[model samples]
Each structure stands twice: as structure tokens, then as C-alpha cells.
Target: MAVAGVSANRLELLTIADAVAREKNIDKEIVVEAIEEAIQKGAKSRYGAHHDIRAKIDIKSGEMALTRHVTVVADDWQPEDELEEFNDSAMVRLTDASKRDPEAFVGKEYIENLPPFEFGRVQTQMARQVVTGKVRDAERANQYEEFKDRVGEIVNGTVKRVEYGNTVVDLGRGEGIMRRNDSIPREVFNIGDRIRTYIYDVRAEAKGPQVMLSRSHPGFMAKLFAQEVPEVYDGVIEIRAAARDAGSRAKMAVLSNDSSIDPVGACVGMRGSRVQAVVAELQGEKIDIIQWNADEPTFIVNALAPAEVSKVVLDEEADRVEVVVPDEQLSLAIGRRGQNVRLASQLTGWQIDIITESQDSERRQREFSERTALFQEALDVDEVIAQLLVTEGFATVEDLAFVEPYEISDIEGFDEDTAEELQARARDFLDRQAAILDAKRVELGVQDEVMAVPGVTGAIAVALGEGGIKTVEDLADLATDEIRGGYEVKNGERTKVPGVLEAFNLAQEEAEMLILQARVAAGWIDASELPQPPEPEYEEELAEGEYDADAVFAAAPEGDEGEVVDDEVPAGDPDQPENA
Candidate 1:
């Protein structure tokens, strides 16, 4: 396109702008504005750089106008910023301008028409830069608007180039980048090669809007399955959960709202045609399509498929589960480098442990022996009787000590006298153990008030003192995570934080209760203000002459006259799987 003074026809300018707009895929009005800016820049360079030069172009007839404007300002006009010097060429004082023009006032502009001039060598270069910069900005804006809301959708593109393990993709109208970690393992892409990627993120930066693409995102597999399986796209069968190990392996849990359809079979298709399509696109990544069950344990069993599970032990409070399989199936259940169990854990939202049946049996035997030993030492019984008590589900000495006399007497070959004798021995053992732990707590400088908190046991008091929580105030200040354990980021890595009562195996709710009770004991809160838990089912009062260990050896402050609650410690369930 020729300049204003080059005798270029009026319609010729609009034709050039229209062509540029179509080629750049931007609006024609943006092109016209950019050209007007370019002309204004050139006029400034030819006239005075300080003058306020303006340019306008009529889009229809392509009529051009050039004008210079000087605005009247206050006599004491100040520049916009400290470093900006006042320009008299663009601004004139009202008092001075009023002498030349009788009606001149502040903010009034004196306008003059300027004849169009040919562009010089430097002006032409400056105009080119102005127009190019404006057009580039408009293109970036258009690109950002087009792709900003397209994240999580799949898109097709051509590989523009690969630099430093990052693939740059030309997404037709915009460019996207897939970082090394976001690409499938060992996958390669060459320049100009056709590719399909998931739009995972779109970020606006100073340079441009970045369309972050990925082939390894778990959502990519879900989208692939949606495209391959009609039921998934129509929401007849839902993809409940998905986990991927990039190009190596993946697991997907599907659920069918309609009882007539089998979710797994539908995903598998006839002879696995549907899943095969997804697998081929993922570079032959193995896909396990498991039917999801509403019951978590059942779902977890399905998640660890192909390896028959002998048993599943769930610790609901810990969000952990242990799966026992036959010895020969251990390797298959764990997969290569533990990938199978890891993906299962991710898919089920549970921390999974894979164990052989023999290993589980050994662990159970160990726990049995340990409990048998405890009963013998606490009740002064022989191995036969100790084993009998363990076999009957008596774990802690406290349980045997505090249980109703009838519960112990009902055992075979046991009479009232034998039950009474066992009760005496169990209570004596608890009294001795409590005294020992209380002495140790004192030696560790634990305050008596720390033991007075509801739910605090003698052993728990000692544990707290050893963990530097020696006072009720100290315990009151703690968050539940401090007592139940959690993770923290340190040195740019996640590190496990050991809880103060980690060894007690306290549940999250138990930890919260302990802290809240401590807060009341510390005078930080009122006991009445605490959340009241549902009362436990009432049991009949123990026989009048029965030794009450709870009343005698319960930990308490010197002056505390309040009731003492039972141990916060887990009431060891003898039947529980040892490794659980």
C-alpha cells in the first residue's frame, strides 16, 4: 500500500487492510486502527515529535485526514509524572493562548489541518514497526480469546517443532506447548507431524497466552474413551475414576446407572474394540476397565483385578486397606515396580498394601503370640489359659480387668471363684502399670494438670511429656494434625511430620477430642462449650466388691474432682488382621 502523498487511490488503502486482516485472521476494524496509528506515528516524525498529531481513515471510501492539535492548559500546568518534562509544543497555557485567541480556555484544543507528506527513510521504518506491533498485539488477544475457555477439551494440531524435550504444536490458529513431563513416556513427535493433545491449561503471560497441551493427562484417556464409546459420551455409563502411569499403564473405574448395561463390558466393547482404540492412541498403554461398586472395599477388590484377593482388611479411619493374595499372585498384584497396586490406590482413593496370604498368616500368629504373652504376664496365668483368653478375644489387660465378672466367668472350665481371681490379678497389674507411667511422666517434668484432661491416660501423659507437650496449655495449642500426624513441605519436598501421640494409633476424631478437652482444662475454653459426643451404651454396674481399676488408678490432677474417662488408646481388637 502506498503512503498518503504517493497518489494511492482511497479504495486501495481499504483493500490492503482487508487483505491483511483476512490473512492474520483478525477483524478488519483492528487493521484499520493499526494503519491509522502507523500514519499518526509517521506524521509525528515529520512534524514535531512533541506535537499531538492525529490520523483517521474512513473504511468505506478510505478517506484520510491528518491534523495537529495543541491543548490549552492552566498557567501552572504540571507534567503527569515526576520525570516527564512539560511539552509546550503539544500544550499551551490558557493565559498565553487567550492573547492570540480571545475565547481560549483551559482544556480547549487549537486544531490545524496539515498537508500530507511523503514518508522519509526513518519515518517509513518507524511506521512499519508501529503497525507491526499493533497487529501482533491484536493477534495475541485473538489467540487468547479463542483458546482460554477450551481447557480440558481435546484438540488436533501439527507439531511445529521440538526444543529441549518440549513439543511446540501449531493448533491451527494458535500455538501450544507440551512440556517433557506432560508428554507420554518415550514418545516422540517430529516437525509437521499430525498430533492430538489435551488442552490442560491456558496461561496469559507477558509474552503471550500459552496453551499448555498434554498427551499424558488422565483426562486425555477419558476423552479418548468418550470418543470411542458412545455410552460414555451420552453419560449412560460414567467414568467414575481414572488413574494413569502415562504410556505404561492405566486403570479406569466405570459405573452404569442403568442396571441392564454392564459398564465394564460396554467399555471393553466386542472383543475389546473400544478400549483398543484408546490404547493405540496412548502408545499401547494397557488399560484396565473395572466395574465400580458402591461399596469401597468391593470397588478396591475390583481395582486390583487379575490377581484373586484372599481377603481385604480396611482401616476406614486411616483411609488405608490391606489386600491379601496367594503367594504366587504377589508379583502380579504388585505389577512392575509396584505400578498395579499404586494405580489401584489412586483409582480407589485408598492407600493400598499388597501382601501374600502366608505373610498375613505369619503376622496374625505374631499378634496372637504377643497378646498371649501380655495376658500371661498380667493375669499370672499359664500359656494354656493365656492362649484361651486371647482366643476368646481378650486383648489388653484393661479389657480383662474392667469387663463384667460374668463375661470372664462364662468361659468354659471357669467358675465364679476363677473369674474373681482373674479380676483381682488384672486390676493389680493395671494399678502397678499406671503408677509406673505416672512416675515416668513426673520425671519427664509433665505437669499434673496435663493428666487431668478428659481422655488422657497415664501412658498418654508420659507420651506427651516425652514429645515436649508437658502442660495442658501446650496440648491445648495443638492442631489435630499435630497429634494425628500429617505432611509438610520442607526444602521444596514433602516431609512426613511425626505426631506427638503417633504411637498411640489415635484416630483423627480422637485427636481432635483430646485437644479440645485439653483446651477446656487449660481454661482457654469452657467445658460446656465443647461438642458433646453421643453417650455410649450403658452397661450394668460392676459387682459391689469388684476392684474398680478405673476409679482407683485413673490419671488426674492433684485437686481435680471431676470424672475420669477411660483410655483414649485403641481397644485392641484381637480379631483384626495384624498387618492391617
Candidate 2:
């Protein structure tokens, strides 16, 4: 107690801690931990006698508190080692009650509070080292939690240092690393540059929080849009699809709930104020804001902006698109080494094949020539023979393209020599017709209008000339069931299930195609307008015991027996109920 008041030793320790906390702008709790560690180390060194001494500091008033070592014991003081005698180093004293009863224990208590001991040169150095380590660890852990939630959120940070292809940014709260891959290719970060980046990933480590930032992620584009466009923020404009090549260029499709507001106009703002803001943040990366379309072809056309599209042919079943552009625009549509088409494909989720108008026309010409050559060969024989061949079904140029000489000979009135002659002539005709077809095909050039009947290839035309159901629009107008009936007698007589018509045997896929073609010809019809065949009335067979009413009436006894009467109402007679 004599050493407790105004002790020079304790006053100096308190003063040092209080001043350090204020000067460093650190918490008072940190200074208390420092002081307690210092005093404990000093006590252990000077009084090498006490093993369990604790100390505390009052940071506000610069006051010190101290306690001595003590250990608890059981009431029964029987010694585990009976052979050892008691010594000062580890001693126990019995109470008066223990002496009388022979079962009492020596109760442990703090006998005295030691004075604050002054540390020697070596002891003082060790204490400072321990305190510094603890304070730094606490600071790092606190910083880690604060920054972890900020992941995926955009933040402004200064470029502090760059090393090993990683950019270190000072986020004010902590430091973040932007790996080289996450940095946009077009962006060049430099020291002291104030930049905006998205926190993509965060992790805790033994040292501190590891924050990963990114500028190239697709989400970064969405976030940038959210910040730039108020319509997007309020949920009025929804981003339907977005794609980016990061620093170079990107395309985004947006849709609006209110049809009166154009999605593209809403995002662009007046004089492109909003989108320009986003572009500036992205270091002038070009962005195309397109109106989202539900129709795949329309959407694809929009995606390839700046390159005007002449046509878009969507093969939905094949999940592909054939985009046609003018000769001048072909290179633009495909972009530099197909980059534009590739990005458009990624954006629309469709495989894209780009073709120039002239190239497409040329390709069609070649196909048409090949088809026409095949048709002319079939037509080179006697008129009767050619007419019979057409009747048996070789109508189209494609039909006869692959026909063998033997198959032609098998037709009525054609001998092997004639078959050979026609086959050779057909090949020659194909050579000549190919050129004509090419000219026709080129003249057509990706037309929306369906062609007229392919030169007498219809049921009536074929009965009068050759192939039936060659075109879908023709098939739509024909009576399918009646055609099916007539076709079965001709070709499907051998099978258990008679084929009604040649078209009836078309594969499921071909049937669907025919339906699509029909739809295009007259536009799809409503179910109500299409005639529905009536259900057949089932005839009920008479049972064995059932007889005619006339027989029963004739067999009935005179007038008393109930008679089935036939009442015929003559022209002017009053009408009577049938049941009566």
C-alpha cells in the first residue's frame, strides 16, 4: 500500500501510453493493452519470483493497477506426495481448525500486491515489440471485414503501385489488387491515377483482406449502365441482353415497359448525355444501344449495328441464321476478321452465316442450273413416254437428277436402247439447262414471294402433265384426304396401311415444312375457319330377339290387343304427336 500512491514508476508508464494513443490517432483500448503487456514483462524480469502477475492502465486518467499471483486449492489438504517436505518455493500453511480436526485446508489468497517494477533495457525493448504486433493485427482484421461487403460494388480508388502485372489500388479503407486479366485491354492504369473499378472477389488472409477488382467483367457494364441511366435504376428499362469485348466495343439490348418510351432513346438520353457518361467512364469504348426484339431475326439485325442488313433468313429448327448484306456492306457485316458476326452470334445465341447479295445470287444460280439439267433429261423421250414418266412421278428437275437409266427403261414402252438414248440425252440436256437455271436463280435474288407452279407439277397439272404437291401453297388448296385416297391405290397397295397420297407419306419433318410453306402462302388460318370433318355416326346392330313393328302388329289379336298404329296425316289433316 505504501508504494501505491504517486509512484513514479506507474506514472511514467501511464504517461507514455496516453501520449502514444493520442499522437497516432489510435483507440484508447489499444494503449491499455500496450501498458498491461509492458508492466507484466517488467515484473517477470525484475521479480523473477512471481509467475502470475496481472496489470492494467486507465487510459483517460493515466492510472495504473496491479495484482499478485495466487492459486486455488481443495479443502482437504492431504498431500499427493507424502514423502516431500514443505519449502518456501512451494509451501502450504494449515489453519487452526485444520490442526484440531486433522482435515482442514490452507486457503489461497493474494498475500500482497507488488509495487510496479522498473524494466531494465532488454526487458523494455521486448515489451514494446509484443504490444506493436498485437495492435497491427487488430487493425488489419477490422479493415478486412469493412471491405469484404464492398465486393461486386464499384468504388473509386487511386492507383498506388504496379508490380508483377498486378495493379495495387488504395481504396481508402484497404488496398485492392487488379490482376492483369481483369483489366480491360484498352485501359492503361498509371500511378496516382484515380480510377473506378468493380470489386469482383474478396478473401481473408493471415496478413489482411485480399480484394480483387475488375474492369472487364460483363456485370461491370450493367453496373455502369445502372449508374448512368435513371430508367434502368427505376426498373422501367430492362436490359434484355448485354455483351462486351471490354475495352474495345460492346452491344446492349434494352426493353421498356411503357411502349410510348423508346428503350434506346431512354438509355441514350438527350443528345446522348447518359450513354456518353458511361462511355467516358469506360475510356471511350464504343457502345451500341439497340432495341430488343422478340423476333430472333429482328434481334440479330439490331445486334449487327452500323452494318445495314439486306435480309435475315432464320432457320429456327437448325438454330442458324443466314444474313444477307449488299456487296459493299458484306465486309462490314462480317467485321474485321468476322469479329462483328461472332459478337452478334454471342449476343443473339444463334449461329450466324453471313453472305453478300451477289455471292448468294451466284450460289442460287448454280443450284438451279443443276436442278434444271436433271429435269430436262426426264423430258427428252417420246411425248407419251415422257408423259407416262411424269404420271408415275418424276416431275421435278431434282426428281430426275439422280434417276438411273434402268429405272427409266422400266417405265412403260421404253426399251434398253431407248432408255440409254434418253439417259445420254438427259445428261446433255442438263448441261444446257444448267445455264438457263443459273440465270433464273440469279434473277430471283432472295425473293419473299413464292414462285408460281413449277411448270405443270400439280395434281390437276400433273394428271394433265407431271408432279403433284411440288409446292406447299398448292398442297394447301388441294383436298388432302381425297388426294391421299387416290395416291394409296397407286403406290401403297402392298403395305397393310394404305398410303392415301404421296404427300401423306412425307416424313414428319417434311410435313411440318409443308405446313410452314402453307402458312406463308395465305398467312396462317384461324382454327375456326378451317373445316372440321364431322364424326361418323355409328350404326347399332339389331339384337337376335328384336323384330319389326309391322310383324308384331299383324300378329296381334283383333282389336283388344294393343296394336302398333300407323297414322298417316293427309295433306290438310291436323298434325298429331308421333308418340300418340
Candidate 3:
């Protein structure tokens, strides 16, 4: 150890540096850096700025000292409390001031000594505060030792505490924080819970080191498998990929290095002991062990298990699948609320739509029927006009006896000018055959299908027509309760009036008239808008041959199979009654 006469205790600085380096486990250079900074601060405080002062330290010898630069003066001034300009006015021989002349003069140059210091109580207190901070900084560096190289490694720790939804784990030498987002959902940890997680990342900070842990990382499952399977450790099996719905389900794709030793079997021990261990660690989260495949269809089939797929129509460009199965298997293949297909889609990164046999057939049949009906209906109005005209004996223009311009105009394709020309030429010929034709009323005899109701009248028919409620189709389209609310009947002391046309009272004739008008407006009685009449299911009869096709054909009659001639009317006649 070394000592100083008027400045420093030489051994003290060396001893302090050695102590800081050893206790904080840091390099001596760091402590030296701290000491150099401290001395510069102390020197500035002890010496005023008027003096140009400097300091040096010898770590090996543990010695420290200070020196001051002074300038000589020619005026009656000493190098004590005055500015350097006053000293500049003095002139003394520099060589004499260097030798300490007894009679010193102005304008001379020399150097003076500033003694080394042993820090006073105030300075020592400040130095100690700085040393404490520096040591903590050094310790922070040491704290990162275990975490810096351990990122992405598996670690287990006891839960120290929970704060602000973050779990703090005691990792023996240090603590790590498992943020709420980093934890698997629906999973909770207690104070003493022994939690296993992957080291996600590490960061060095001023206070200490921070290690981030995660349980939701997909790699955590893969790492856990490696720990349980020896083949995975020795490179005989590989985990191809893993997809997880954390805390609920996970699918892991694995393949074998040697095809003979099944990769899935190796990961799942003889009785599933290996995977069971992993499942227990994961708090009963289900694991699907899938065999990896280069062929996507086979992989998808494995991903969706227990539900057999009848066919898979893959759309490679869109990365989707249309899976079809038997009608009875639809619910099973779709699983409870489609959970099975959803998980399979997540695992395979594909969109899947599941369909049943009946649904597929119905879809195709609807398309075919619509296409055919559209083709036939496009130009078939001529047939309907021909049949109606034939019943009226408007079979030929000459049969009319006296052709009217309006009668010719009534024909759909005949123009007005053509009708006028034909009527003028054919009047006499048309009039001659008019008496031989049948009565117009007898030609069209279709009647109203509904029974007449009492108290109801044509007032309701006029109201229904004006209100756009003209038909059974319109009435059936409304809910029963909605229609019922529209009707009003007198109750006790109040006179009631119908809010809707459906509730009006009418006589039988009026009801018949209403029904006839409604049918004409709606185009049907039990309208198409009503619930469809169930088709006759002749499946059993047809299968059992209850009726022979040959006998049905033999029983059918022929020969005009027609009605009488009493109802025939003249051609181009306009007075025929309308029928439905």
C-alpha cells in the first residue's frame, strides 16, 4: 500500500476498486471507469475555476495527486486570489520564479502544487452514492448471464406472484414475467403453481434482466414432444408442423425418418403413455396425432377422423374443398355444430364445405327443371289462344256469318287494319252461320269452388280488391294471427267494425261473388302461395306392383272421348262467357 502527504490515501482507491469488481462480479476496468469519474468531480469541487487544475491516479501504487497552473505577474500582485490578467501585468524572470526567487516580481511564470486529498465527509458521501449506483449497474450485467443464452429454451419455475394479470415466476436465480397475453386462455396459475413454459425472449435493463415466458407458443408443444420421445431426440422422427387452438385442441404433424418405424406410433407410445404425459402437462388439452404426408387429400382425411368422407372435390386454385357424404352421415361428418370440419380446416389451411347426397341431388334437379321450363314457356301463348278460340266455334273466319272488326282484333296476332279489312269482306258469310251455333253461356260453365257464407256481402269484395288483398294467395302470405287481428266482432257493450276485409259479413250470393273475384285476381283458390300440397308418395305402391301398367293402359278410353255439340258457338264470336 502507498500513502500521500497532502492529497490521497493511496491504498484506499485500489482497495475500493478491487472490492467493487469482486462483490459485483464485474471487470476491474468498470470500477476504474467509476473512480476516474468520481475524482474528476471531486477535484472540480475542491479547487476553484480560477486555477487551472488537473489530477492523476496510479492504480498499481494506489497514489493520487493534483497540480495547479499559475502565471507570473509584474504588478504588485501574488498568484493567489486575482485573475490571470493581473498576473499578466507582472514581469519577473521566469528562470528565477522556477527557482523560487525570494523577491518575486510581476510578469513571471511558474507552477504551484495542489496537494492530494482524502475526501471529507461531504465528498465521501457523494462518492459512496456514485459507487453504489455503479455496482448496481455491474450487477445488472451479471443478472443477464443466465437469460442471455437461454432464449427459446424450455424452463420450469414456481409462480411467485400475480400482478395486473401478469404471472411472475421464480426461476431460482431470477424472476421472469409471464404476461397475460403470453399465457394460454382459460388457464390460471396460483401462487405456488409449478409452471412450465418456453423462454420467449430476454431483455437487459437498468434495474435488472427481464425474461419473457410463453405457454401459447406452438413450438412449446413440439419441444415437449421431443423431451418425451427418444426417437425425436436421436433424429429418427421429426415434427413436421404444429397447429394449436391453445387450451382446447392441437394438431401435430409428424413423419418418420425410416418408414418402418411409424412416426406417430413413436411419439405415441405403446399405450399412448408418451402423448398422455404431454396431455397431462397441458392440463387435458386434446392432441391430434396426424401422420405427415406430401399428399394433401390423405393428410386432410387423417385430420378429419371418425367421419368417413364419400368424396373430396378439391379446388386447387382456390385452396378449398367440397366434401360429400351419404345423407345419413351428414350430421356426423359435420360434427356437433361443424366443430370437426372447422378443426380440420384450421389444421389443413383450407376452406371446407360439407354436403349430403340428397342436398346435392336436389340442387342439380332444381337447376335442370328451371332450364327446361324456361325453354318451353318462352313462346307458348299461341297454344292457349288456339284452344280458347276453338271452343267458341271461331274455327274459321267465314263461319262468323258477319265478321266484326273487334272479333278479328281479338285474335292475338291479328292487327287492327287487317281486322277492319277482313270484317268488311266477310259480314254476309258470317251472319248466315250465326243462328246454327250454341249459346255462349253454355259454352263456358265453370263455377265458384267455395260455399256461400251468410251475412257477408259484396262490400267485402270491393274492400278486399281496393286494399290489394284480392286472393287466397294474398291472404295465405300473411300470418294467421295478422289476419285474425284484422277481423272484429261485437263484444258486450261495444259495437265492432272490421279492421281488414277478411272479417266483413256478407250474404251467400255476395260471398260467392267475392270468392269468384278473389280467384280471378289471385289466379288460384288454394294458391301456390299456400303451403304446397304433399306430392302423392307412390313409392310403396310402385315397388309392390299394386297396379299393373298394362291393365291401366287397357282401361283408358278413346274416341274424341268428347262432350256434346249443344254448346258450340260461332267463329270469331266475342260474347262467349269466361271460364277458369
User: lDDT winner among the candidates?
Assistant: 1
Order of models, best lDDT first: 1, 2, 3
lDDT against the true structure, each candidate: 0.85, 0.64, 0.61
Q: How close is candidate 2 to the true structure, as a TM-score?
A: 0.48
Per-residue accuracy of model 2 over 258-342 as CA lDDT, tens digit each: 8887778778777778888888777777777777776566677778766777766666545677877779998888888777888
- Alpha carbon lDDT of residue 505, candidate 2? 46
Top TM-score: which candidate number?
1
- TM-score ranking of the models: 1, 3, 2
* Model 2 error, position 524 (Å): 57
* lDDT (10s digit) by residue, model 3, range 250-349: 7787888897987777887867789888888777778877777665666666566556666566665446777766788778667666766787787788
Question: Of the pair 2 and 3, which is ahead by lDDT?
Answer: 2
- In model 1, the worst 10-residue window by lDDT is 571-580
Identify the superior model by lDDT, candidate 1 or candidate 3: 1
| Model 3: lDDT to the true structure | 0.61
